[model samples]
Target: MDHREIVTSLSQEQRDHLTAKSDLPGLPLLLSHWGTILVLGTLIALKVPFWPWLMIPQGILIVFLFTLLHETIHQTAFRTAWLNEAVARSASFMLALPADWFRYFHFAHHRFTQDPDKDPELAFAKPATPWQYALHVSGLPVWRGHVKTLAVNALGRCRDGFVPPKGHSKVRMEARAMIAAYAVILILCVYFRTPVLLFAWILPALIGQPFLRLYLLAEHGRCPYVANMLENSRTTLTNILVRRLAWNMPYHAEHHAYPGVPFHRLPEFHALIEGHLRQVEKGYARFHARYLSELKLASRDASK
Candidate 1:
């Protein structure tokens, strides 16, 4: 069945149950995520034996906050509106992403999933060549784009069609505030002659970004460009740890099909529509391996 049909087939009671929002499940998960980050950061700060190695997991945890940011923007991470907004803003700052701007951008993506002309994500285009794939995975392009976006938005010159005029001021202010906060952090670090942030946040985020790029690519990469969410998005069956870190976003097709369903309820949602999902992947590793093979084959075909 198509995505719309799948949704329509669900009874009102089922729909209601799936869409129900609650903070109970989110709070503990949030605490555990943050608690782990805190512990890792402390270990690094103390320069424990093989402390540098700890950055790997630390970076992964920190970078995965993007998932939290994504969910909170939808206001489905928690039942409380304020809690969602608060967590989104925090995650945005940590990731150097402006929450207000991203909300419009992400909403447009949902509205026009895989639409080459309209989806902002398509503007950058996915990596086609092996070299390009390496660069994409390196995360440099996204980092550059984020820095540029923040600067542009801070100047009140955001030209994205998705951001309505009413939100321009808010976006601009949010960008400016983020810039100012970053500046303060930098200034304090310099004044203290410390590399605390460099070790604890910056390096780790950079180290963790490639993994995020890989995970995010699986969400829609190579999926058919169609109106049906079931066809246009991919659901990667990943491990429980990854699911916890990503807030169940591994269920991308289920999400695009029924966005109102909160993250905590995604597994249940997946079970109901498992047979209907069109672009499910076994795991991220399998997806990337297959994707790489396809790229190589395409390169050879083009050369011929």
Candidate 2:
């Protein structure tokens, strides 16, 4: 969206809220934030039996909260606007995504999600013709990885900013605040002399990022689209791992099609739309078996 599209002047009509979808009863969704803190605290306090298994639950909860925060970033999950922004940014830092930068590009992603020329996040997708596969094969610390996520925010804080399809002065201001925050984080790392492996770099990228990217990739990865949101995103079915870790985010299509529906209410929304989804395709799956299989075929083709 262009700067003109940001809609900063919330007119009388604009302030109106989305209608509630059902009376299946609203949930105490604010509890989700507390739940995240509880898990993070438990992990640090009980730092015993340091194993991948021990981290599984804690890391999963981190990812779940992160995803929920993502929806909040869109201003869809909750009634309280500032509360939604706070929840989104806090969870974003926990996930290592720059909330400032995320807010900038995410607005674009929503407006031009499927448009090959428009979406920033999907620059790694097929439309962007990226070398991410090569980067993946070479390894994770892709020097470019940091830049890819930060680039727009960097430019936007400049005079013209980047090609924001929406918002203008306020968007530029948010971008600047985020850059300042980034500096503060680095200062904290330097003061403690935290090892690159400990605080400066590795843990955030390694422990949390792959999970973040996996969550992102699954949303639109290799999935065929239907007539609407029901086909644009994937739903990982009834897997508890998917639900707890991604905050029921696997029901992505439902969430997008009906953004007013809170995360707690997504299952209800899904039930309402499931029939429409199945009729379009066979629904969705979480395994990366297709990615694995595609890489093998691509390797063969490249060798030929």
Candidate 3:
């Protein structure tokens, strides 16, 4: 069955139960995220033996904050509107994504998920070769885009279709504020002659972003460019740790089908639609292996 069939099968009570927003789970999830970051920060601060190894986990934790930011943009991270905005701003800084810009950008993505012509995400093509795949997994493209986005928005060049004309000034202003914040961090690092930001954010983000890239690719990598969410998006079955870190975004199709449902409730949402999902993958490993296989096949056909 398609997404509509699945939705129609569910009773109104079940739908409400799944879509009801609450601050309860979101608060604990927020605390857990901070707790993990704090523990890693303390370890690095003390320079514990092989503390650099902790950077991998730290990077994973930090980079996955993108998922939190994504959910917050949907205003489903918390029941309270203010909490969602606060977390969205914080995550945007950590990830070097301008929240206002992303709000418009992401809403466009949802508005046109797999439309190659309309979806902003499709503007950046997926890797078509092994070398391109390697570069993609290095997370350089994400950083490059972030830098470019910030630079353009800082210059008040927010002319994208997703960002309304009325919002252009506000978007540019927020971008400038973020750029100033980053400038302050840079100056402090130089004045103190310390790599505090380096050890804490930069290196960790660099080391950890590939994981995020990998996870994000599976969301819609080979899905059909159709209006049906189940056919257009993917839901990769992953472990509990990944689910917790990503705020249940692994249930990508469910989220797309019912964006009204909060992150904490995605599991229940998935339970309702699991059998109907068309693009379910067992894991990221399997997803990438299949993606690469298809790329190879396409390359061979193109050469012929």
Worst 10 residues of 2 by lDDT: 1-10
Q: Model 2: runs farther than 4 Å from truth? A: 1-60, 63-65, 126-172, 185-205, 225-227, 278-286, 298-304
Model 1 lDDT, full chain set? 0.94
Candidate 1, RMSD to the unseen true structure: 0.8
lDDT by residue for model 3 over 106-212, one digit each (tens)?
Answer: 99999999999889998888888877888989999899999999999999886788899988998899989999999998999899898767887789999999999
Cand. 3 TM to true fold: 0.96
Pairs of colliding residues, candidate 1: none
lDDT at 62, model 1: 91
TM-score of each: 0.99, 0.68, 0.96
What shift in Å separates residue 283 of candidate 1 from its native position after superposition?
1.0
Q: Against the unseen true structure, what C-alpha lDDT does each candidate score?
A: 0.94, 0.54, 0.91
TM-score of 1: 0.99
RMSD of each: 0.8, 7.2, 1.3
Q: Backbone clash tally for model 3?
A: 0
Ranking by lDDT: 1, 3, 2
